[model samples]
Target: MKNDAKTRDELIGEISRLSHLIEDRLVPDNGMTDDQLRSELGLLRDLAEQLSESETAKVLEKPAPSGRVESYQRIFANSPISFSENDMSKLQTFFTGIRHSGISDFRWYFEHHPEAVAKCAILVKRIYVNQATLQLYGAGGIEDFTDGLMSIFHEESYRVFREELIALAEGATSFEKETVVFTLQGERKDIYLKIMVVPGCEETLSRVLVFVVDITDRKDAESMLEEMRKMLIRTSSKSIDGNNSKREG
Candidate 1:
């Protein structure tokens, strides 16, 4: 049982590392198209899943961990909403540096240095993501999801993140906002995003939970209502104009 666990861990770790390597090799001049990368990474994900399923059976035959841990794992894995665990240590360090640099007005600094906000975003590292997140982002696997992570964020999303950064800088531990993101297939989605820094992990900013709720349908409905309201206004204005002309004649 012990050897089985070790072998499984090693295999998973090696596969994850290789996936990162492939991601790093992605450059404009690399001559590899997005489709090719997705195909290759999809194969890696299939192999990893097969190995994991085989090893998990053996691991389960042995004594499992505490009931609490098992329960948390179950809930996290099967959660309906998109949930992602992120390591923000690097971003935390960057925040620390910003403070040390004596930037009292973070808003001004960020506004003036918009690129810095973009840089801060790239520093966040994904630790884990649930299946819902994979489906939400139209990702075949975690590797493809993480590799194309930044591609999902657009200018509007960055505006929301800028608010998040300001909140974090002002010592807030949680934030929520309505933003937009794109799937791997380039479909725009309106999302309600919430970010919470796990209680004990606040100092290091190592573990953060992000929840994303798809709100596109609601937004679309609201937009339709607004358009109907405008049409009604136009019809009323035309009727009023015809009545006034008849009265004048």
Candidate 2:
């Protein structure tokens, strides 16, 4: 624990020192010593050199399309978000091709985990948020389906889910994990919702990024895994009891 605390303090100090360095670069002050400048550059250069080619290869796999981040920033700053796919498509300036990292990740997540697409419903702008966009992005359906998912969101649930996001935006609180759940025709089904928020993130990051992973299959697997764990514990206990009985005998 002492080591962990020391490590955490070191990381925090590094971040604080780096922030000061950025400020120092913009507005020069003699507060920073000459050696500090050299130290910082040396550390950065070492970090760059230490990065394995395989890691860079992943980011460099696809060239981000032009004007992606700039356009996205513009839309985020200017538009009243209406999360509909058609409207999102209209924001073509935000993402032209699948070259942008954010777009690529969004595309990958949507296609791979359709259930994750609509999970951002609470935080989404009412105008831009819709089933169409979710479907196009493969983020799953916003509404519950009659065939399997008769899910409905109550007022309290909405409050609990959305309030956290608004609070994060307002700087009242921050969270690493947030969840939303659904009940089908009053019965709890496998459908669930989740989101990740980063309020004090850097310039390249958005305030929040939500994921809707359909855990139906995963939930089933978990149930089986849990049962196995229980069985193992019971067997282990029985074995221990036998060993103790033999020792007593």
Candidate 3:
């Protein structure tokens, strides 16, 4: 009877062990709820605690690693936004004395509307005005970077691009509508901008989020489409005029 009881315990333990092995092989992602996994992990902890002294030493003595920070550094170095030689110093100063940062989080760049900044006819690097802007460019903080964006961008826009930057810098300009020209640059007709000034967030430091999309082929197609539309409209109008003259005759 005692032998049978030991055999039953062994079977249950093996079943639990197999389940843990299955979970270990499973990739860690948010697709599934953590509740079940947490409960299973707790069970495993309890089993570990219940293990004999010799087994406990084997489990406890195994050392955990020190690779998480190094792994994150490697990922940062390999990112698409290459920090050039001239850019590194300002960036380093910006990162200096800061402990917490979302720099490793790739989603921030996409969300910050960087494509709009990248497409500006006259690029405005914060370093051009306030030397401090170098550090704040891609940093998660918004205040200093967004401050006086129009005032800062106006001169460069005018100097490099056009007079539109002057109005855009002054409070008189409204950028809410989508501009076709804003998206097209060079022989490539792929410039498009969706500019919106967020309400209650229009302070000098607050950013008027501009979303830019490149559709050069689409823009060229649109130009052709506009011409076709005009031709169709003119042809239709002429037909109506001709019919009116025939009716009068």
**Among these predicted structures, which one has the highest TM-score?**
1
Q: What is the C-alpha lDDT of each candidate?
A: 0.67, 0.36, 0.33
Residue 99, model 3: Cα distance from true site in angstroms: 27
Q: What's the best-to-worst order under TM-score?
A: 1, 2, 3
Please write out the lDDT profile of model 2 over residues 1-249, one tens digit for every residue. Answer: 245334434543544454354445433554755455444434333322322232322322332233342333333332222122111111122222323543444334434643332343322322223443243233355433322111344444444544443333333322322233444435322333333333233221233332232334334434633554465556668779889999999
| Candidate 2 positional error at 108, Å | 38
Clashing pairs in 1: none
lDDT string, candidate 3, 135-208, tens digits? 22333333434332332233223232222232333332233222333211112223323332333332331323
Q: Looking at candidate 1, what is the lDDT of residue 207?
A: 72
Clashing pairs in 3: 147-205, 183-191, 183-192, 184-191, 189-216, 190-216
TM-score of candidate 3 relative to the true fold: 0.25
Q: What is the lDDT of residue 128 in candidate 1?
A: 76
Question: In terms of lDDT, which candidate is stronger, 1 or 2?
Answer: 1
- The ten-residue window of minimal lDDT in model 1 covers 59-68
Candidate 1 positional error at 106, Å:
2.2
Best candidate according to lDDT: 1
In order of listing, the candidates' clash counts read 0, 10, 6
